[model samples]
Target: MQIRLQKIIADSGLCSRRKAEELIESGKVKLNGKVVTRLGTKAEETDKIEVNGVLVTQPSKKITIALFKPEGYITSKSDPHHSQTIMDLLPKELSYLKPAGRLDKDSEGLLILSSDGELIQRLTHPSAGHTKTYMVRVKGFPKPQNLAPLSSGKLKLDGYLLNPMEFHILSVKDGKTWIRLRLTEGRNRQIRKVLDSLGYPVIYLKRTEIGKLQLGNMKKGEYKELSEKDISLCFKT
Candidate 1:
């Protein structure tokens, strides 16, 4: 069977179809010892395909793992700060897995780990508009007017304006407050910065859901392989 070169690259988990097309246009992709920049070029299973001089072959079964990351673990592959990484908690066989989206070192909860680069790109892309739900415990209760800025898109942090986000109050205690926030964008310490600017600093934050997948009862420091249904739902409309 033959398939478009971009599809082959995407199916191999090298990158998304759009990114594969960009790579093709950049003349980084080769077929049969020749640089092939034609977007519509097709390749068979036996065809010798290479990207950036590395042999490209169809990837094996895609693996998706849902991990409950604990606090104090970095979400990177290697950190010069000498901090422990999320990979340190995984089994030896999962060393190749990369985090789909990042959770700050002080925050914890559901982190999707996968070896499928295309799936990672799809899930993390802002255009995909996948909603990430977070349970935030703040230092103080904020007035309704304080949350107005979040929806108004006027909340600017570090010279970058934040996107409109949905905020829902979950509970309130003596001085502490619990809130559920949903956002389609992932910026560095975005939720925390927003709350801090509103005079209600975030004390603890944990991601509870992504798209239709919920963290459910997964314990801290534990992980589970995603089912076929989970994979389908991730990219489903």
Candidate 2:
């Protein structure tokens, strides 16, 4: 069966569909040694496809892993300024894999890096409803009344109302307090902003879970290859 060239590139997990289209238009994608820049170009299974001189083929064995990202590492492939990225922490054998989503440099937790684009899409897409849980330490403890707006699901941020989430106090220590939050949406810098809006500026934040996947006891900078059974467990949560 013939499929669009971009589908083949995206299914290979090299990039998203939009990025694949960009590569095709930039004359970087070739089919059977011929540069094909037209979108919607169809290619059959037997046809050879190459991107930037390397043959494009699905991996024989699919791979996915849960990485405990430590603070200070950017969640990107590379940076022009030579900043360290999460990819630098993985073993050379897993360099081809890409992060399904992001964890900011300051937030450390369970980061799913995988080669399965379909799985990545299902887990990260907004409609998936895979709630991410975070342990947050804020500057000061706010009374329950102030925290009510966050859980009510009506908190407006920059003209956008947020999806309903659960915020609970986990512990109270001197000068700071630890709280747990469950979020349905993965907005950039959302956890900090949400808490800050409630008069509790977040000082430390770490994602503890995403769906059924848990950070567990994994130490900073540690990574574990998830088996088929292990991957299946994530959806159950």
Candidate 3:
């Protein structure tokens, strides 16, 4: 049976359906030796599918990796600014995998890379409401009342009102404060922006956990393949 090219790619575990659409629009996908830039193009099992000149074949096994990102590495596969990207740090065999969610160049910690489109969508989609926990170090100690807004869902910024979530102060010392924050929404530079708006500018931020997955004891720049159990726990219904 013929299926939409994007769906075929997504089901093959290459990327999420949304990213498949991007691959198609960018002219990176071809069907039966013909470039297919249209969103609704179809391909059958008999049709040859190629992405960037390499024929698409179903892998014998699907893979998911969790990487302990270090500061100064970009989350992108490639960058024009000559900055080091996470793809450069990974093994060449994982070149086909894509990051489920991005970490800023200056920030660090728990990054999930995978070929499983469905799992990627479950973790990255805002509607999933998965909580991401961060250990943040900021310049000054903020009053407990200031953090109340984080849970009260009253923190408004840039014409947007953020939902209430968990924010707990872990410690404060030497003019620096360490706090733990949990957020369900993954807005761009969200942690930084929220802290900035609170008058306690962030000095450092690292995501320590996503859902039940923790970055415990994982050395910086190291990566580990997710076990079947880990994957199952990650997507538990």
Tens-place lDDT per residue, model 2, 100-195, is 889898888889988786677767777877778889999887767878898887788878888988888878889899988888888888888888
In TM-score terms, which candidate is top?
Answer: 1
Model 2's C-alpha root-mean-square deviation from the true structure amounts to 3.7
Q: Which stretches of candidate 3 lie over 4 Å from their true place?
A: 1-6, 12-30, 34-47, 50-60, 235-237
TM-score per candidate? 0.84, 0.83, 0.82
lDDT of each: 0.86, 0.85, 0.84
lDDT of 1 by residue, 1-237 (tens): 888999878766677889899999999999999999999999988899999998876644568999999999989877998899999889887776778889999999989988777788888877887788899999887767778898887778799877889999888997999999988788999999888878899999999888778889999999999997886665543
- Model 3 agreement with the true structure over 1-237: per-residue lDDT tens digits: 777888778866666788889999999998888898999898777788988887776433568999999999999989999999999889898887878888898899999988776677777777887778899999888988977877887787677888787988999899999999888877788889888888889889899888778898999999999987876655432
Q: How many pairs collide in each candidate, listed in order? A: 0, 0, 0
Two-way lDDT contest, 1 vs 2, winner: 1
Whole-model alpha-carbon lDDT for candidate 3: 0.84
